[model samples]
Target: MTGLIETNETEAEAARKAEADAAARKRVADARKDADELAARIKVDGPRIVGELLSLARECAKQSLIAKALNAELPEGETPVPQADIVARDFGAEPRKDIRSRDVELWVVADDGRIVGDQAAVTSSDGITGHLHVAGAGLRWRCARRKFREVEFNPRTFTDWPGSFHELIRLPRLDGPGALFDGSLLTIEAAAALDVAASVKPTKRQPRPVQIELIPVDPTWPPATAAAPTEADANS
Candidate 1:
């Protein structure tokens, strides 16, 4: 009876050890699968981050005009301020996708009571491109206090092409009211002649992502092909 009891005890111990080993192997396998899924997501959405950042920077630059248009309440002792035409820029796109979301303020102080017409200065990075002809979809005006009016279009539009040197330099497919010019329309012809988004360096804030991917356009693509339609003027 004593010998039998010893054998039973040894068997129980072996069974427990086997179970522990099996559980450890399963844990390793699960961890690897989780890592792979995360990696795949990063690979797919990482390129567009820079374009989003550029868009954010452009929107922040428009604060002065936006505040004036919205009739925003200044500080208690703030003087009555003049409003100027708000302008945003298309700087370039960057590669990193890990982005935080935040609000950017665009403000322009005008000596005059009303806004100045066509008061925008813009600059582009060698890696980014925005022409007067075709661009990404964005509103000419934004709802005050809700969100920024300027935007960076999705970089996935260019995924079907040759990638950029790295992530930060992708040329995004962008559209703004300024891109298309109908030479026939009087207003269109006048706008086409302007080069503000092309020339001025805008005030920019940090880049944020609404969706985790938070990527921007790839710089190397022919941006016009991926262009989508957007509102020309929000005030309209």
Candidate 2:
């Protein structure tokens, strides 16, 4: 009888332990899921918020300077008016011309972890994975995971492509120079290959998606023969 009682108690304890372990695992999984969701949100929204704030702050600073200058006399005849007055005088002197950019999308190919050229690539209509659409000023780039959070391109390192489609990009980081997001800028013609209907909206035309493939360079790759940099390199 005592043996039977002991066996029942042991089984109950084992069951309790199993339940505790399952609960612990569940909690850990939940935490990881939450963290991933937050990370995705940050990646998508972080850049846009930062850019808007920077722009807003700049506008505020200019307005404040102009307000202060308006109350002060313009310093006598070229004696160097306060910086504020100079800026304020120029603020609306000329008509503000809006700069329009044609939205272009392209796939940047990568070779051995570097962007080889600025020419964009034509993408097929299949599902896009391991690829992203990047768009920005002529050669400068701004890539977003979703919206607002833009990745800035550094011109110096990217111009070193030697025919292979590989180049390095500087992503935003709290620490200086985030890891290289390597890829190419598709040539202008690749814009025709974009999924236009998927990108358009009923109320507005969306910015074209330029898929950028971020691949880190392998420190282990063999070195190549030395050669002169091309025109693109010099221009970049």
Candidate 3:
């Protein structure tokens, strides 16, 4: 009789628990339905307001990230300042790709709002090359492509080839002209027209990859097919 009584009590408890769960589920469903009805009442403004709020949140997050990355703050008594000129680079160490720019700022001064020279002082990206004027340094020139070799000119030897020597200097597939550097620089036209053999000096330690000499531009010789000039050729 006691076992029967206990079983009846357990069944009653389970029934009550099931009823409670159903009520809780019904409340959740009703709450979701009410939210949907409320959203439907202000269909247009609701979406726009939500979108704007999300955008504002995103902007706040972005500013937070920028502050963390830069660790920036205004000095005491100074107002916040915005910069128009900003450049992006690879953020971390061990960068593989190098950032290259021909239009570079050569000089800058920050005291008392003073700045000198315009961007035009440097050559434009259009074909024209600019050379640096470095005192007492040999000018290094490279072929625009990975061709047979590079050419270096001694100071003040960059001039038109007079074709005085018997040997010929040949540079194949010339890709415009490169920069020339000396205490006083020369323009690209002046540098390209340089007498290669006269300007290039034989180095004692470094082996010359390609020997150059000046030969008369002959109709008999094929165009762009000249070899390195020998001692006999030079003597001739």
For each candidate, the alpha-carbon lDDT, in order, equals 0.42, 0.44, 0.41
Estimate, for each residue in 183-203, the C-alpha lDDT of model 2 and write its tens digit: 244321232232333322122
**Model 2: how far is 62 from its true place, Å?**
1.0
lDDT of 3 by residue, 159-190 (tens): 23332111121221111233212312433334
Please tell me which predicted candidate would have the highest TM-score against the true structure: 2
The local lDDT score (0 to 100) that residue 15 gets in candidate 1 is 100
Residue ranges of candidate 1 with Cα displaced over 4 Å: 62-236
- Model 3: ten consecutive residues of lowest lDDT: 82-91
For model 3, name the residue pairs that clash: 167-214, 167-215, 168-213, 168-215, 169-213
Give the per-residue Cα lDDT of candidate 1 at 78.
73
Order of all candidates by TM-score, from best down to worst? 2, 1, 3
Assess the local accuracy of residue 60 in candidate 1 as a C-alpha lDDT between 0 and 100.
36
**Candidate 2 lDDT score at position 58:** 37
Model 2 residue 13 CA deviation in Å:
0.7
Error of 2 at 77 (Å): 25
